[model samples]
Target: MASLQGKVISITGAASGIGLATARLAGERGARLALGDIQAEPLQKVVGELKAQGIDVIGTVLNITSNEDVDNWIAATIKHFGRLDGAANIAGVTTKEAKYPHLAEVSNEEWEFVMSINTTGMFYLLRAQLRLMLPGASIVNASSGTGLFGRPGMAPYSASKHAVIGLTKTAAKEYGPKGIRVNAIAPGPIKTPMLARVYGETKEESKPNEESKPKEDLKPMSTIPLARFGESPEVATLVAFLLSDDSSYITGTTRATVTGLLGPPRFWQPASSRKSTYGYLPAGQELEGEAGSPRLGLTPAQKLAAAEARRLSQAQKRAQGQLHRAGIEAQKQERLRKKRVA
Candidate 1:
């Protein structure tokens, strides 16, 4: 692990998912942290948990879309830590609708809402961080795989993420001379709250119920070479590396943690042209057997193993769904109790 000892790092969206994962990992690697989020209760809860683990940390509740909020949070971080060595701009949101609407159907309000947080808010945070950061400081911004390629019915989101890449590259070129580095990470189908929401899964469930299947056409896992969702900690590890000296030579590039989903061969080929056995192979072009016949499908043992893996995965998701429901109920009860006391 790349050590972040004594480094003072600031992170946005630190209340949950990838942001929360990064905060925990950075703290464990000995970094002093300033965490900001729109949710005060969850942010404080996370800060308290980290503090108990002996991590040097502070929490601030602020809307990233507000310039004043973004500026004040950065200023407060510098005041608390004395200096900022690194930052992870991880705050972002998707379209409000459960099903993404076509560009023609999307209203101005929806477009502005996504752009305000994902693009303009990022600009505000980056400007403030750059003003205070010294040479050798590093910053990592969150982009998305959609940023690289257009997704149907996600015009606003795709445009905003593309803007993220544009800003990251521009910042890197301008700041590289001063010894500062800027980069972006484009993640695909990470197992986070955002993904859950995108899949139409409610807070009470990890997977969509039979009646409420996801509105999107793509089956996310089936398209990916990894055949599973990327985990939060996996992306956090990359962010940590970018923040540390380990990635000093790397800047201005958008690194993808997409599990080969965006690899040239897979991405360029049409779905109908591809087949998956042990790996992705062009249709009817797999490895040949000793008799020179194409090996078209998995062996019986391999099929059994695949079946067992899927069964276990479904079981895990069910267990997670139960836990999610329990947590929500607990929160609801707590809120009611507080209301009663007041």
Candidate 2:
């Protein structure tokens, strides 16, 4: 692991989710932080928490969409910390409306809003940070799984994320000679407030009765091979790795933090439920003496082993699903308690 002691780092969207997770871990690693977010109260709270722990931190209220705000935040960082070693631009937004309409129905306002924050705002942020960063600095930007592959009903968001990757690559090349590194992270369906909003669920209605609800109803989560959503700390670790000297040779690439979810949600059936063998000749049937023959049988032992493997895999998957539901319940209770306090 790269040593973060005494290093000064800047982070946007530091009030919550992956950004907040990164800030917390970075602080624990001994880095001084310059945190910025539009949510002033939450940002200040985080700053106070870190300061109470003896971590050096400064917080600012910033709207990434404004060039001036971007510049000011960077200036504030340098003014407070005296230098910048790394930065994570983890702030971005999606549409408020769920079930995004077709491309033809996407409004001009929606397209511009997403582009302004996700792309143009990133440009501003990167430029400002790079202007003050010394050689050997690193920066990580937020991208999405949608950036790598297209999905229906999310043309604007997808396009904006694709543009983010482009910016990351171009910046890496432009600054490589200066010893600065740039990279992007593409995460799929993280369990964040943003995701809850995307699913049209508030804290009160977020957790469902797993026993009563069919597993298929989980939609995207069911499609992931892990059968669970990723936690914020998972992405935080990736961002920290990219920002640290541990990843000195890495740059100009988009790293995915999804839980083995390659693309769109597709209907998945377990091995026993699937009708086709998918060309897996059952474990150990001997081929006929004929040169070009196919045998469709399995030895008793082979069948037993195969069945054992499938059973173990299914059992592991079920355990993971149960653990994920438990986590969701914990998150729900915390949210509700916070609401009550407010």
Candidate 3:
């Protein structure tokens, strides 16, 4: 194992996905952890588990969009761990609502939300970490494959991630002389909860073949050169390496962890298939009525409602899945206990 003995690493979005994986690996490699996430229950659960295993850890609920939250998290880390050695700025969000939409169709609200979190939130993380980082400390920010290239309907997300690279590089130069290393990892098609949200949530993944679109071509696996979604641990290992002494000489560079996919694939296949009855109608604009066409296009209000319904549905499914997994875990523990008694 690559040892991180005596190193104290702070991670954002640490309750789940990439952050959770990195925390586990960091524990295995002998590092103390300061984990921050927006999800309180999960954050506490993860921290409790790590503590059970004797891993030094402290977790807090953090809203990365707030400068105050970021600042306090960093302060709490230093207070708990005594000093900070490294950080993984891994908190971010994705979107499917803006998929395949024209740039003009994107709303100011949507644009601002994505940028505020993915871009500005990262800046907050870097700022706070750099303030207290001792010499030789490392910082790894999470960018995306889309950050490297543009994708249709993903303007806001792509732009935000791209900004992450710029921030990473700039900070690397600023801090290199002081012995701090800053870098980014552009991961492609990682099988994360965030990816699930982008691709219509966890329930969509489990739907029968008959229920899903039959003609859908070029799935995420097919788009990637490796023909598979990258696992969380795979990316975590890379993050650990970047945050460890092994990559001490590396800085100011963004590494692509994509499975040989150079850029985004053509998400929209058939040109005719791209056509929809509900076109991109700007807010406050009336929908065009086609008397000859059997249906009038959906109004802007209706479209927003549909999108909200999908979001809520996805959330419900995700919650159910979590509960199901918890039940399974309880059962497994009971079985183990009975075996021990026997």
lDDT of 2: 0.78
What stretches of model 1 exceed 4 Å from their correct place? 203-217, 259-342
* Global fold similarity of model 2 (TM-score): 0.73
Taking all chains together, the TM-score of candidate 1 against the true structure is: 0.75
Model 3 C-alpha lDDT per residue in residues 1-342, reported as the tens digit of each score = 567888999988888899899999998899999999999999999999999999999998989999999999999999887899999999888643424345777778878888989999999899999999989899999998878866555688889999999999999999999999999999987888776655455665432233222123223443455657889899999999999999989999999886334321122222333322112212233333332335444444545666878999999999999999999999999999999999
- Model 1, 184-257: lDDT tens digits are 99988788888777776655544443432443334445446566788999999999999998999999999988
Ranking by TM-score: 1, 3, 2
Clashes of each: 0, 0, 1
Worst 10 residues of 2 by lDDT: 274-283
RMSD of each: 24.3, 22.3, 24.7
In model 3, residue pairs whose N, Cα or C atoms come closer than 3 Å (at least 3 residues apart or on different chains), thus clashing, are: 100-153
Global CA lDDT computed for model 1 = 0.82
Candidate lDDT (C-alpha), each: 0.82, 0.78, 0.78
Off by over 4 Å in 2: 203-218, 259-342
Residue 280 error for model 3, in Å? Answer: 22
